[model samples]
Each structure stands twice: as C-alpha cells, then as structure tokens.
Target chain A: MPRPAVEFWFEFASTYSYLSVMRIERVAEAAGVEVAWKPFLLGPVFLALGWNDSPFNIYPPKGRYMWRDLERLAMKEGLPFHRPSRFPRNGLLAARVALVGVEAGWVAPFARAVMTANFAEDREIGEAAVIEDILRALGLPADEVMARAQADANKLALRCQTERAAELGLFGAPSFRVGEELFWGNDRLEDALAWACAGAA
Target chain B: MPRPAVEFWFEFASTYSYLSVMRIERVAEAAGVEVAWKPFLLGPVFLALGWNDSPFNIYPPKGRYMWRDLERLAMKEGLPFHRPSRFPRNGLLAARVALVGVEAGWVAPFARAVMTANFAEDREIGEAAVIEDILRALGLPADEVMARAQADANKLALRCQTERAAELGLFGAPSFRVGEELFWGNDRLEDALAWACAGAA
Candidate 1:
C-alpha cells in the first residue's frame, strides 16, 4: 500500500507560508504522513484575481491586523519573526531554486532557509547573492545549484507549477492537497494531515 | 477584580461565524475566560473596502473553497450544517434581535440559535418570522423582543456596534478582542482565550 501523502503548495514571500514551512515536516512526521514539497509563485495567482499587490498590502486594516496576528502566532509557535522591510518581495528566483531542490531531495530545508531569510532575518531572497548565501549555508553546491536554478528550464518549470496550483483552485499559500481536498492557510496543516491519515476528515 | 474576558465580534451572515458562535462558550469556559458577545455587521465593513458583496461571492475561488472548508470544519466539530440556498441572507433582523439579547442577558444562546438556523437548518435568518421563531424557542416573548429589537434605539445600537467594529480595524467576522489586541477567525478563538488569561501573549 502506498503511504498517504499531501501536496504542500507554498510561496516564499507569504507570511502565512513562513509559518507552515517552518513546521510542516514535524507535523507531517508526527502524523505518519508523506509530503510532496511544491514551490510556486502567488504573484500570478493574485494578478489573475486583479490584485496588483498582496491583498494584505491592498487592504490597510486587514494588513494592520495580520502583522499583529502573525506576531502572536509566531510567538505561540516558538518561532522567530521580524516584519519584512518590504512587502511581497519577488520570490521568482527563490521559487525557481526551490524547484531545483524539489528534484534533488533538499527542498524542505532550502525552503525553510529562504523563508527564515525573508521573514525572520530581514534578508532579501529575491537576489542571487542572498539565495547563493542560503545555498552555501546548507552545504550544497552553490555554483551548480544556482546555475540550474536560474536556467530557462527551471524557470519554466516553476511557472508550470504555479499554473498547476491555479488549476487546483489554490488562492493562497501554505495550502495542502490530499487527493481532491484542498486546505488553505497555516492553521489547516493539522487538519490536512488528519485528512491524509484518515482519507476523510 | 473583573473576570478576564474577551470580546467576540461576529456577524450573523458569516459562514465562519456559525462555527465560532456554536463553540466559543465551551472553549472560553475551558480556559477559565469570560466572553462578551458582540453582534456586529460585516456588510458595512466590506462596503468600506469597496466590496458590495461577500468577498466569497466576489472572489469565486475563495468562495468555492469556503463552503467546502466550512462543511469539513462543521463536521469535525460535530456541528450540523446545510448549504444555505442564499449566499448571505440579510442578517439585519437577526443582528438587531441579538442586540436586544445582549442587554437582556440571553445573547449567547440567542446567537447560537440564530447561527444554527442560518447555517444548519437553512432558515432565512433575515426574516422576522424566522428570528421570532428562534426567539420564542428560547422561551422569550417573541412579540415584545421583536418590538424592542426593532425599536429605533436598538437599531441605532447595532449601527454603532458595527461602526465600532470598523473603528477597531475589523475587516472580517469571528473576531476576538483582548483589550487592544484583536484576533481574527475561529481558529484564533483559543489563542484569544489564552490572551485573556495571560494578559499578554
């Protein structure tokens, strides 16, 4: 019998995604479930919804509340957080690199490092230098991975993955897919794991 | 000393509100916290954001996911649920009656009944007849409560409460306020209760 699994769809720049990326592995392992890491861009998804910017930035009141809510949630989860100096930093390069990690079996740690850089360490994950630093810190071949990550094929692959997310009816990141069921937000991680284990929840 | 309490701001028309309304009391009591029931309107709050309809209705994908998510959540909690034929039945009348209950000290039960009627029974919560039936089921004088709920003073109170919701920077329902900190969504209910108990989190 195949191990029950879930597809984790995440974007590097999403605050909520930061929460899930930081903890999904532990949660899934505890639930005895398997995970397929999927790195995708939310920019195209939001653009298709006619949003030129992150909805958090577009709606001020919601944006205000979200920052405070994220802070509280991070504290509760024992995670470090620093508000990003910039909102919705371009995740195109980081996502493409994550796509490279996906094939090489190191996506989870790489995604966590990138998320920590963007959300907790106040570093820009959009530039090659920052991403290269993350790659080297992971003791991976920075030169080789960076070359493949920036290649046209890897870039195209990230775009296709994003398109697949759209086709799956994803509107937000840190989303989980178990069969046809889709669970959105960092809060639903546990529920998605339960669905994965039980096949119905 | 006053019992540590959190203010629950909710709207009768909201699907997520149905989940919170039914479960808040049990959760709060378990945490040794008190709950102050707040019945407010989301229509005006959304209107201020230039949304004339429910964000779910305006955004097709989010709307599509919400109904399914709500069903799963309801099932998990052992709460009865049926998809309402109408997306957002005018919650005006129900909210007004809830305001009356707030003063009369029956708001919690009243809110739960209305929520059940709206989400579980597929009743039209907007109509006086449906609301009146709920009121009578609670053993209240339907005629007197309806009269008072519709009185100009009570109507003004609901308006002021909604304005307060906006002033407090609420863009959504099932919100909990612990003094200055505001927690949004039913998922945050437990966290909000913790804040009430700890005073800071």
Candidate 2:
C-alpha cells in the first residue's frame, strides 16, 4: 500500500513558499506521509488571473505585513532569514533546474538550496551560474544538470505543471493537495498533512 | 497590573473574523490574556487599497478556495459551518452597534453573535432588523441599543475606529494588535496572544 501522500505545489519566488519548502520534508517524514515536491511557476497562473506582478507587490500593505510575518515565522522555526533586496526574483532557471532534480530524486535538497540562496542569503537564483554553484555545492554534477535543465523537455514540463496548478484552482503558492482537497499558505501545512492522514483512514 | 491584552480588530462581514470571534474569548482566557474587542469596517480599508469588492470575489479562484478553507477551519475549530448566499455583506450598521456594545461591556458576545449570523447561520446581518433581533436575543433593550447605535456620536466613533485600523496598516479583518505588533488572520490569534504575554513578561 502506498503511504499517505500530498502534492506540494510551490514557486521559488513566493515568500510564503519559502516557509513551506524549508519545513515540509521534515514535517512530512515525521508524520509518516510522503510528499511529492511539485515545482511550478506562479507567473502564468497570475497572468491568467490578470495580475502581471506578485499580488504582494501589487498590494503594498499586504506586502509589508508579509515580510514581518515571514520574520516571525522564521524565528519560530529556528531558521535564519535575511530580506532579499529584490521582490519576486525570477525563478525560471531555478525551476527548470528543479525539474531536472526531480527526475534524479535530488529535487528536495536542490530546491531547498535555491530557496536559501534567494530568501536567506539574497543570491540571484535566476542566473545559470548561481544555479550551477548550488548544484556543485550539493555534490551533484553541475554541468550535466545544467545541460538537462535547459533542454526542451524540462522547460515544457514546468509549463505543464504550472497549467496544472491553474487547473487545480490555485491562486497562490505553497499550496497542498490531498486527494482533491486544496490547502493554501504556509499555515495550512499541518492541516494538509492531517487531511492526508484522515483520508487514508 | 492590567492583564496582558490584545486588541482584536475585526470586520463583521469577514469570514475569517467569524472564526476568531467565535473562539477568541475562550482562547484568550486559556492563555491568561485579555481581549480588547475593536469592531471596525473593512470597506474603507479595502477601498484605500483600491479593491471595491472583496478580494475573494474579485479573484474567483481565491474566492473559491476561501470558502473551502473556511469550512475546513470551522470544522477543525469545532464550529458550525454554512456558506453565506451573499459575499461581503455590509458591516457598517453592525460596526456601529458593536461600538455601543463596547461601552456596555457586551462587545465580545455581540461580535460573536453577529459573526455567527453572517457566517454560520447565513443571516443578512446588514439589516437593522436582524441586528436588533440578535441584540434582543441577548436580553438587551433592542430599541434603546439600536437608537444609540444610530446616534451621531456612536456612528462617528465607529468611523474613527476604522480610520484607526487603516492607520495601523490593517488590510484585512481578524487582525490582532499586541502593542504595535500586528498579527493578521485567525491562525495568528495564538501568536498575537503569545506576543502579548511575552511583552508583559
């Protein structure tokens, strides 16, 4: 029998997504649930909803509150946090690279490293060189991974995944899907896990 | 010394505020904290942010997810759940009445009753008759309370409180203020309580 599982859909550029990506693996493992790390872009989804920029950027007060909320949450989780100089940095390259890692079963660590670079260390993960640095640091073959990441198939895979997110009616990132149930935001992580567990019963 | 207290800023029409309003007293009491009920309007706040409609209604996917999320949260919180036929019912009259309740030491129960009317019972609380029914159900003189609620002073006081919310950077309902620290959403109720307690310590 398959272990209780949830599909975690996240975008690297999302601040709330940073919270979930950092803790999901540990939380899921401890709860005896399997997590399917689904890296997708929120840009297209936002575009379809008629938002050209991050909603946090489009709405200033919400944006201001988000950073402070992230700070408090990071402290609670015992994670280091440094505000990024940029808001909603490009995640195309990192996401494409994550698609490659997914196939190799290293997506979790690769994604975490990219999130740390973007949110914690304020590194630009959009550049190929920075991604290469992350891969090499993770003891993976940076050159080969970069080659696969830029290839036609990986790019389209990300597009399809994003379309899937829109179809799932997702308006934001760090969303979790347990069966057909959708849970949004970092706070709902525990609830999603609980739902997955309850469904298995 | 005064008990460690949190000023709960809420809008009567907000769904999440219903969740907080229903359980805040119990939760705050258990934490040994005091709750300062501040009934305010979100209409002005939303307008200041250039959102004429509820963000949930403006963004369909978000609106859809919100109802489902509210249902899940209500179930988790052991509160009754029902979907309101109308979204974003006007809370001006309700807010004014709550201002009256605030002075009479009945704001907590009054706010909870209004929230239950809007969310759990699907009643149109925007109507003066419905609000009067609720006030009378609590054994208060409905005619006197309603008359005071419509008075110029009480109406203006509610307006001032709403302006206060905007000045505090409150873009949403069910926001908790501990000193200058602001915690938004029902999920942050505990965090706000903790912040209050921590500040007192």
lDDT tens per residue, model 1, A152-174? 99888998999999999999898
| C-alpha lDDT (0 to 100) for residue B30 of candidate 1 | 89
The top-ranked prediction according to DockQ is 1
Q: Summarize candidate 2's per-residue lDDT along A32-98 as a digit string, tens digits.
A: 8899989999999999989999988998899889999999999999888999999899999999998
TM-score of 1: 0.98
True contacts kept of 1: 0.94
For model 2, the superposed segments whose C-alpha errors exceed 4 Å read: none
Residue A64 of model 1, lDDT score: 95
